[model samples]
Target: MNSTHDTSRHIGVHIDRPVQEVYAYTSDPTNLPAWARGLAGAVEKVGDQWVATASALGRVVVSFAPPNEFGVLDHDVTLPSGVTIYNPLRVIADGTGSEVVFTLRRQPEMTDAEFERDAGAVADDLARLRDLLESEG
Candidate 1:
């Protein structure tokens, strides 16, 4: 794949927890700081959206999909530049546990290194989530 076009990569992890429980915890914006390092170390509620006042991309706003039965935790993160990136995430049943999958889409202008870094970040975050959830059991 060339850097001139967009690319989609799926990063996932298997958490030793029920799908519903994983979905409930992950779907909440306030719980993001504990696992989603790519988002921010902290987030605040601003009106109906979650705002990260200090992030690598500067201040950003996050909006999540309403609660749903399909385990979808999709969200949009609007950067300081006002460019909103759609993040597709899901927690699905994996026997007694759950599998969290995050679709990381590389922007058209991102270089190969940047794309890989973003993918790595997602992988790390998912691993963190898995660790946090599995330890609870």
Candidate 2:
């Protein structure tokens, strides 16, 4: 469901559950680590603010959300250059299911290969979410 490139990446999957449940799971950062493969743990508020640490990707604190629809995160990944990563997670409802999009734009000096690698990581995370939800049912 996820992809990477010089172009924008889109990752989506159809869940059998209601849109609200899917949105709740994604919007609540505390629940993120339960399904997100990249996150080891997260602390978050109900309305959608969070600070999280990824087992492999380091720590991140979500900075803002515009109109409660999109989130911007200030993320730090421990790498050689120690660069900051900006990630946006958007959620929208479509009919009976929900659509989630993860967009990443890193430091200007970041290479396309680096972007692709991270994008692929995002895809795997989403896939893990799908498995979690389906398994629960």
Candidate 3:
């Protein structure tokens, strides 16, 4: 499925850490359970793919973008029912801190209220990530 054609919401949070630090942590799927409670319960690697026991979708395969210096953290989530969702995420440098952005897309059949709730969940997750990272500093 093409995510660009779907409705999307961009939510972000400012972390009191360097971009590299935030990117390194967030880009690792294993860390999703710590911050993204709405998305994952636990993430583990099976063969070449990373599988997460997601709170919303159960067990799903997750594939992240290749590591680069630009702080891109995009990933693809494939559900057990054979649906794939593309997520666009980024970590950007802001002074000595960093900004993490997550683009949440609405499924084609989702209602307006559902979309809003999903965005809110993403916002909450970002806040959790911010709090988790900042608290460690």
Candidate 4:
């Protein structure tokens, strides 16, 4: 539970949109591939759980926090190998715009290079989200 003890990277981007609007779009699991390149291949819902066909990880189940007004977009991704990754995401109001933050946790088996790569991927995704949302504004 101690995030300080664990290795993690926090990446975020500022979107030129209101918090509510940003949350509405990003909170939807179906929109993940639009910004998340790792999951850009395919995403579908099966019953209550969402499954994503990521190029590097293959098939994985994705679970998100229940609908709420707090702009908490936290999600968990379960890999085919049964390893579940907790991704902490949030959309916070900043003036008239919003900031989307994604915390990337380094897996126990991952090397430093892999962890950096994951962080880079998250940065890229967040930037994509910013561009998509801003351009729509």
- Local distance difference test, candidate 3: 0.88
Better of 1 and 2 by lDDT: 1
lDDT digits (tens) for residues 1-137 of candidate 4: 23335497778888889999999999877788899877646899999999999999999999999989988989899999998988899999999999998888878777777777888888988998999989999
The per-model lDDT (C-alpha) reads: 0.89, 0.60, 0.88, 0.87
Ranking by lDDT: 1, 3, 4, 2
Q: How does model 4 fare in lDDT?
A: 0.87
Error of 1 at 62 (Å): 0.4
Candidate 3's C-alpha runs over 4 A off are: 1-6
Clashing pairs in 1: none
lDDT of 2 by residue, 75-135 (tens): 3333324544556666666677666677655446567777678778778887777677767
* Candidate 3 lDDT, 56-122, residue by residue in tens: 7899999999999999989898999999999999999999999999988888878777787888889
Q: Judged by lDDT against the true structure, how good is candidate 2?
A: 0.60
Q: What stretches of model 1 exceed 4 Å from their correct place? A: 1-6
**Model 4: CA > 4 A from native:** 1-6
